[model samples]
Target: MKLLIGNKCYSSWSLRAWLLMRAAGIAFTEELVPLDTPDFKETVFAAAPGSGGTVPVLVDGGIAVWETLAIVEYLHERFPESGIWPRDPAARAHARAAANEMHAGFTALRGACPMNLGKRFGPRDRGPGVARDVERLAALWGQARERFGAGGPFLYGAFCAADAMFAPVVTRLDTYGIAVDPLSRDYMQAVLAHPAFREWLTAALAEPAIVAQDEVDEPALVDLRKS
Candidate 1:
C-alpha cells in the first residue's frame, strides 16, 4: 500500500487518513506531496487518477481510494480484525455516526481553525459560528467519553476509526487554544500524546514548504520547526 498525502502541517484530511493507518499498525509506504505547488495538481492526478485534485489518496495493490471516510471504510472492510471500528455492534454504529458527522459537518469550526501542526498562535476572539461549533463538539465528546469511552482515553476508548476521524479536530482546537469542557480537554490531551500523532507532528515540523494561505494566525507566532 502507498499513501499519498499533502503537506503535513496544513492538510487535515491527509492527517486523518495517515493517523488511522499508522495507529492500526498498517505496513505501508508514504508519499508526501507539498501542497499549493505549481505542479501539485499534476502530482495528485498522476499519483491518484481517481482523486479529483484532492488528497489523502490510499493506493492498495492496484486500487486507488480517495476521500478520507471512504479510505477509512475500505481499510476497515479489508482488515476486519484491525478493529478500525468498535467491536460491539451498537458501539460501532455510534462511532460511525460520529465519524460521518465529522466528515460532513463542523464547517464553522473547520473554517476557523484549520490544522497547522508547525505553527502556534495566541487565542483569538471566537466568532459565534465557531463558538457554537466548539460547544457542540465539546458536548458530543463529553457525552461519548462518559457513555462509551470508559476503557481508555479515546472516543471509543481504544483509538478506533472514530478517534482518527476526529484527530484533526483535536489538533485544530489545540492550535487555536480553544477552550473546551474538562472531559473534552482530557480526550484532546490523550490524542495529542499518542505516538502516531507525535510522529506526524514531527514530520510536519520538518517540512520546509510554507503555503501562505494556510498561515491564518499571525499573533505571536512560533514555528514548531524549531521546537
Candidate 2:
C-alpha cells in the first residue's frame, strides 16, 4: 500500500489520512507531492481514480481511493484488526457521525483557520458562522468523550476514525489560539501528544514550500504544552 500526501504543514486532509495510517500501524509508503505545483493536477489524476488535484490518495493493490473519510473507512474494512473504528456498533455509529460531520461541515472555521503546524497563531475575529461551528464542535467532542471515552483519552477510547477526521480541527484550535472549554482543550492536548501527530508535526516543519496567504499574525500562540 502507498499513501500520496501533500505538504505536511498546510494540508489538513493529508494530515488526517496520514495520521490514521500511522496510528493504525498500517504499512504504506508515503509520497509527498507539494501542492499548487504545475504537475499536481496531473499527478493527482494519475494517482487516484476520482481525485482531481486532491491530496492524501491511498493506493492499494493497484486501486486508488480518495476522500479522507472514505480512505479511513477503506482501511477499517481492509484491516479490521487495525481497529480504525470502535468495536461496538453504537459507538461505531457515533464515530461515523462525527467523522462525517468533520468531513462535510465546519466550513467557516476551516476557512478562517487553515492548519499551520509549525506556527502558533491567535484566533481571528470569528463571525457568527465560525462561532456556531466552534460551539458545535465543543458540544460534539464533550458529549462523545463523556459517553464513550472511558478506556482511553481519545474520542471513543482508543484513537479511531473520528480522531483522524478531527485531527485537523485540533490543529486549527491550537494554531489559532481559539479558546475552547476544558474538555475540548484536554482532548486537543491528547491529540498533540500522540506520537503519530508529533511525527507529522516534525515533517510539516521540514517542508520548504510556503503558502504566503495562509500566514497570519494576530494575538499570540498560546502554548498548550502540558506542564
Candidate 3:
C-alpha cells in the first residue's frame, strides 16, 4: 500500500488517515508532498493513483481510494481483523456516523483552527465563529466519552474510526489552547499520547515547509468561557 500525504503540520485530513493506518497496524509506504508549492498540484497528480488531486490518497494494491473516509473504509474492509470500526453492528454504525459528521461538518472550527503542530497560541484570538465551534466540539466530545468511551479513552472505545476522525481536532484544541472540561482534556491527552500522533508531531516539528497563510497565532486562554 502507498499513502500520499501533505505536510504533517498543516494537513489535518492526512493526519486522520495516517493515524488510522498506524492504529490498524497497516504497514504502508508514505509519500509526503508539501502543499501550496508551485509544483504541488502536479506532484499530487503524479503521485495520486486516481483522478482527484488530493493528499491522503491511498493506493491499495491496484485500487485507489481518494477521500480520507473512503481510504479508512477500504482499510477496514480489506483488514477485518484490524478492527478499524467496532465489532458490533450498532457500534460500527455510530462510529461511521461520527466519522462522516467530522468529515463534512465543523467548517468553522477547521477554518479558524487550521492544524499547525509546531505552533502554539492563545485562545482569545479565536473569534466568535471559532468559539462557537469549540463549544460544539466540547459538547460532542463529552457526549461521546460518556456514551461509548467506557472500554477505553477514545470516542468509540479502543481507538476506532471515530477517534481517528477527531484526532486532528485534538491537535487543533491543543495548538490553540482551547479550554475543555476534564473528560475532554483526558480524551485529548489520549490522542496526543498515541504513538502515531507522537510520530506525526515529531515530523511536523521538523518540517521546513511553512505556509504563511497558516502561521497565524491564536490568542492564549486564561479561563474557560461559558457557552
Identify the candidate with maximal lDDT: 1
lDDT minimum window of 10 residues, candidate 1? 217-226
Q: Which ten residues in a row have the lowest lDDT in candidate 3?
A: 218-227
lDDT of 3: 0.81
Candidate 3 stretches with Cα past 4 Å from truth are 217-227
The 0-to-1 C-alpha lDDT of every candidate, in the order given, reads 0.88, 0.87, 0.81
In the range 78-128, model 3's lDDT, one tens digit per residue, is: 999998998878778877887888899888878887877776767556678
Using all chains and alpha carbons, the TM-scores for the candidates as numbered come to: 0.96, 0.93, 0.91
- Misplaced by over 4 Å in model 1 are none
Tens-digit lDDT track of model 2 for 87-156: 9898899999999999889999999887877677655667888899999999999889988999799999
After TM-score superposition, the amount by which residue 73's alpha carbon in candidate 3 deviates from its true location, in angstroms, is 0.9
Candidate 1 lDDT over residue span 140-216, tens digit each: 88777877888898988899988998999999888888888888888999999999999998888888888888888
Candidate 2 or 1, higher TM-score: 1
